[model samples]
Target chain A: GAGVSQSPRYKVAKRGQDVALRCDPISGHVSLFWYQQALGQGPEFLTYFQNEAQLDKSGLPSDRFFAERPEGSVSTLKIQRTQQEDSAVYLCASSFRTGRDGYTFGSGTRLTVV
Target chain B: AQRVTQPEKLLSVFKGAPVELKCNYSYSGSPELFWYVQYSRQRLQLLLRHISRESIKGFTADLNKGETSFHLKKPFAQEEDSAMYYCARSAGGYNKLIFGAGTRLAVHP
Candidate 1:
């Protein structure tokens, strides 16, 4: 792909429902990151991965938010029992090296929980 | 705690006017700063980084460790430059970026 791709550009989920967002990063990128952007706010870090290893999950808001990059190419972000506060845009970025190089961001998934 | 602050929520200017979006960060150690831009209905993209000291679309940002600021500036604003701008800092270890709330720039013709 020419750039990072994310699935389900928009999603509407009822409170307590579960939603899954997918990200396919640039082929062979070494680092993948997930971020959440609230309305009128900047994107906040959610988690990070180096290759297939989950190097950092400290940014995940809660146990309800889980992200995995099993193969290092594609990743998924899952939010269980979604709450209204969870409504926001989820963005995925990939970099060829550690972030000093720069990151390419996906279109993002806008999730609305009602 | 590491944090980025963009004080202005919106900045309006006439085309050809000078523009500056303010940003400040609080981090324990030396940090790398960057400016990201988002156009209407488009994905977010990198505009410039302090380390690069390069200008893109006539925009430049310089990291000021003395004042803890990284402000984006342009000599002449363009109508096409209307977009949302974010200031971010790279965290030390994991390299995750901490972003400011964002500033919306509106350039009118």
Candidate 2:
């Protein structure tokens, strides 16, 4: 694809429902990242992947949040038992090399937990 | 711990006026800093980086290690420059970027 792509631009989930967000990074990009942006706040790191390896998951807020990049091409973020605080914009970004190389961000999926 | 902070939530200026957007960061290790901008209906994109030391669209930011700041500045603001700006820090040699709250720049004609 021309740029990083995310699906379900917006998601409305029940308080206890589970939702999945998908991301298709730039073709052949080596690194992928997931971030969550709360209202009036900047995007905060959620997880990172190098190829198919999940190297960093330190930023994941809770056990309910899980992300995977099975083939190192496309990734998925799953939230279990979504809460009101989980409502935010989920952004996916990819970098050709490392963080020093900069990143290309997707439009993001806005999740609204009602 | 690495953290980025943009003090002003909103900045208003008339077109052609000089504009400065403040950014401050705290990181014990050497950090890679960047400024990202988002125009209406556009994805977030990199505007400049401390490592690049290059200006984009006449806007430049100098990383001041002593002050722990990387403030974006432009000689004259343009109406087209109105957007949301974020300051970010990259540390730990990872592909993770910690971003600030962001500043909304309003360049009025």
lDDT of each: 0.94, 0.94
Best by DockQ: 2
Q: What is the DockQ of each candidate?
A: 0.85, 0.87
Residues A76-95, model 2: lDDT tens digits: 99999999999999999999
* lDDT measured at residue B85 in model 1 versus the true structure, 0 to 100: 98
Clashing pairs in 1: none
DockQ, prediction 2: 0.87
Error of 1 at B23 (Å): 0.5
lDDT of 2 by residue, B11-105 (tens): 99999999999999995788889999999999999999989889899999999999999999999999999999999988667748989999999
| RMSD in Å for all candidates | 0.8, 0.7
Q: Candidate 1 — which residues are off by over 4 angstroms? A: none
Give candidate 1's error at residue B81 in angstroms.
Answer: 0.6
lDDT of 2: 0.94
The candidate 1 chain B region of ten consecutive residues with least summed lDDT is: B87-96
